[model samples]
Target: MSTAPPRRAPLFRRVAAALAVLTLPVAGLVAVAGPAEAAASATATYTKVSDWGTGFEGKWTVKNTGTTTLNSWAVEWDYPAGTAVTSAWDATVTSSGTHWTGKNVGWNGTLAPGATISFGFNGTGSGAPSGCKVNGGSCDGGTTPTDNPPSAPGTPTASGVTDTSLTLNWAAATDDKGIKNYDVFRGGAKIATVTGTSYADSGLTKGTTYSYTVVARDTIDQTGPASGALSVTTTGGTNPTDNPPSAPGTPTGSGITETAITVSWAAATDDKGVKNYDLYRGGAKIATVTGTSYTDTGLTKATPYQYHVVARDTADQTGAASAQATLTTAGVTDPPPGGAVKLGYFTNWGVYGRNYHVKNLVTSGSAAKITHINYAFGNVQGGACTIGDAYADYDKAYTADQSVDGVADTWDQPLRGNFNQLRKLKKQYPNIKILWSFGGWTWSGGFGQAAANPTAFANSCYNLVEDPRWADVFDGIDLDWEYPNACGLSCDTSGAASFKNLMQAVRAKFGANNLVTAAISADGSNGGKLDLADYAGAAPYTDFYNVMTYDFFGAWDAKGPTAPHSPLTSYSGIPIAGFNSEAAITKLKGKGIPGSKLNLGIGFYGRGWTGVTQATPGGTATGPAAGTYEQGIEDYKVLKNTCPSTGTIAGTAYAKCGSNWWSYDTPATIASKMTWTKQQGLRGAFFWEFSGDTTNGELANAIHTGLQ
Candidate 1:
């Protein structure tokens, strides 16, 4: 599936929640209405907090000054012709032309006498909010009522409980002035203070009972009464009342490297029994394991880190932390040519079904972050490289709106379709290199015949890719033969040396000026697909190899055990051995391939199954899940909302919603993978295609930022 275009379909994701008519302080901006002469019983005020010339955040605060309660309030304002609201939270925001309105959401609507509420929004253009009104009245709240302490916050509700951590959520409290923050208490003792309604508490004992309460504090620092207590008991540990295990000995460092730190220590003793050891970097828990040894990877070179360990008993109670040890990494790995290569595939067929055109790369903000683009499936038919879709490649006309440069493609134009658009994209981002990829799952069968005469095949590809009409559209050629001497949609028996010969000939034909790459199988099992060809020998001929690390498991198995299709590491009950990114990378590295010549493949989409019994892995499923474009396959954009992640394993996230179970990489998981890529000194990362990411290129941005 990773090698084909059939699975990709149209999908989108939304980042939701927010409108308060929040107002900023009018103190310095204008003369305040003195408290000696009050006007209205209640009022709202608008303030433009910060402006970046291009956009600004506006807020409106509504206050109740009278003895009566205010049920609801709405803040309305207008902007100039070029200004508009982009998005809002804490309320519903709508607009009529240049006029904008915000109303409080269900939970934060009511305001007690002498209490206040607020809403805010992000807007485009530099124009400030004007003609502001609150509930059909002037936004200025002239009256200044006597200040009173805020009411107690709603009782805290706990969820996502684990042996070491739990999540707490509560409703906001009412205050005369805006609420500044809430102090979280455990058994009447203050633990942490935060401004948000939720907090995730960690480093707790398992099987132990705890009581939590929240106290609200207003802007003037007046604290409210504590909310009612909510009792919680973490799962695990034999007895909560048992004494904690003794602290482990100071860690002994060994096997030190630039990107990894391996530490071991004597095990700690417990009265009941030792459960797990908690590893900490500063105050954050990095890992938990029952063993006495741990190796932390993805560390920066020439940097010092302080680490300590705590022992937890069967009751989940932890002992005092061991003495910290500071270790500095040795040296940094050399980055690949042109830094980390952030490449993504762009399929010709996408413009046909998914409506994902080349312009999406620019609009989604992906083009600015990426280093390369692989225009896929140029075709390998009749032992000669040919255009996959002539219309999509150079014949299809594009309208001005759909064009990358906002220029229409005419019938008389010399070049059209994706090729012309790519040319325009290159002109816009002159730094990005474009490679024409030939042979996919459907066209891979032709590679066998093409491999029969490597030189002839190389010659055919060179002539096609360098065709003057569209040669400037591509800087190089890429071979995605699926498997040189193994099976994909079909089987190939061109021998192990066939791939090496073809690649060498292609390099010879293209010479030193052009780039050459290939997408290879990632079956890392002993004597698996990787061994069927001379991948190591062919390594020199390629600018880099795209290890198709996904699709190791999917609905192809049908009626069966569910597994993460793109797990970065091996986990317990992994359905198959060596079917993961770790195994593939290790295997390739063991084959003498340099990490700089390897680009880890990431699937922007997800593979899932329906009729699943559990949210966790290793569960039985009836069949492939229903997807927008194809069964069993869905884009990350849709899966993120359709089935929110329930848990994670082996460095990837999985979710189960209703009867369907899905596995996909989130921005967080992608960051983790990018860290691993750095630890392994890999060249960088490339995703399967562009359409699966969010509108802002969330996943792609994760890679770009994580590598730094």
Candidate 2:
């Protein structure tokens, strides 16, 4: 697979652009104000918006009531000794010692007789300021503003009542100045201020009656009277003698595959509602979920597994485990005549600085496990396929130790590089087929030209792959077109059917017996790459499609709220809704492509960010993290020891150590994903270049064992 910058959602792109222009100061300054010099002519009011542990946001409204039209105005306040303003919006602020002055900006410098202007600021203190002044005059009481308070909010209704939690919803409040927020009160104490009409209250005492009220506040700090009170009684609390939920009905298993089983049970009755169910495998707890069904994956082929379910209620009480159900997974079935295709890419450049040669595959045991190898990547030049690097492909000399068969290359040899080593490996493993892949991310720029005259392009590729010098080294060809009608490293404007036409020409030239495959985009977002081309029309001409499913998110975005690179499911705070492995598979299946013709793609490396302070996935980062080959990326072999996984989320593992945070898949997560692949009925899974894995090929072992 080729690497590209991370793509952003359309809505998030606009937000990110806006944030780039909203820079503010990090340190606060202090300024002192002169003593009051004139009689009070205007009034100013201050309101606190929100307050975190170390910072606070505040707003101020300055109103003119006197008949005189003021040409300019400024507001001053005295802060505590250690407090200071950090940033101000819609106004220019300066400070001296404990005194702060806020001057009007260009747009709101002049004030009419009855006009008011509002400005806000972020500060580094908890306490509100005092000794306020406007235009160097006392602002306490000379003029009364004409703004009216909003009307009281309507009564609230409560539902989903539990022993310790309930939800409250109310009608929206209306105001001339626009309602900004509503303050929720419980037992005469302010509980929360929110912009929405509904709120969930949790952690309440059981069997207790609670009184609630709400008050509407407008943008100018005008608050209306509180609404009428309403009371709700919670359900009774748990008792020492309370009985547990009944044993779940006998569990049943279905959708059994070589490595997975789906188990479900009938709902169990309880004094309180059932909170969740625990699933056990071989007498060990494997998973806990709120639903009645769960898929147990990553098991051995033809292995017998025992499963049981136990239901629990809101009181943390679990019932007796149901009778165990046993199932033996079926063995993998081979294709009728041509065997399942377990293909992986072998980059020509891996023989350079990476120091990975064809010999590594033999030593690491990956060659015996895979069925086919793709030599990537040849390039497309002048509307024809050509060699990307002549030296790497056929001219570089390898020593006896570097060669696959322990034979040194002679300077006069016609073929001497990776092309020759691959030929030697194929001789040892006769079943392993090799295909020459062309048009990677960087070289795909010429595809638009090739699509213009596909017959000529196919002729060029056919003659090159079947050249007499290396005719015995290759079986067929594979097209790694980054995209056809959508954007990748560059943009393509050919019609939607251009890709299908090109694939047809290649199949016609290569014949049916020789394998012809293509790697296509798996973007499932609405109007994404999948919709830009006619993939279904091209599927019939190719043996199978490699669905590139990983790299959904990464640090190519520089500053980001970090997220997993390849999430299998949608979590609570996922950045994009449709950018997951499941969504892509469902989309292709919906597009009339059979599940058995698709092969899932996985990344052998991990992506991450730097300058992260929080351990969770959503924390803000400064930029891309440091790496050996590139920033924001590292091999799984290095990350497995550098930043070990601390927890799992969204079907992936994440780790946070000191100021660095990273996310990657572990052996256990890969096992779970393999189960999902079998459930989806996909042909198999493939990864990128082989050099990223450990010397022992730990990740390769996991993929081989999980697929079995």
lDDT of 1: 0.77
Best candidate (score: TM-score): 1
Clashes of each: 18, 7
Stretch of 10 with least lDDT, candidate 1: 10-19
Q: What tens-digit string does per-residue lDDT give for candidate 1 at 114-183?
A: 7776554556664545666666664344422234447889999999999989999999999867898998
lDDT (CA) per prediction: 0.77, 0.73
Worst 10 residues of 2 by lDDT: 14-23
Cα error, residue 256 of model 1, in Å, equals 14
**Residue-level lDDT tens digits of model 2 in 1-708:** 111111111111101000001111111112223353322246676755444335555667676665555556788878877777765555677789999998875546565567776666656654446667677664344222333456778888899999999999888788765888888989866788899888899999887789998887776655665777889988985575777898897788889887778989998888778899998764457899999999887764544566789999888888988887766567853331344456778888676556788999999898888878889888898999998667778988999998889999999998988899999999999998899989876577799999999999999999999998898999999898877877654567787999999999999999987788888887877557777788878988988888877778776455567888777877888887777787777667545565677887767777788889988888888766766554566788899999999888878888887777788887788788777777666777777757778888777777777777
**Candidate 2 segments exceeding 4 Å error:** 1-339
RMSD of each: 23.9, 19.6
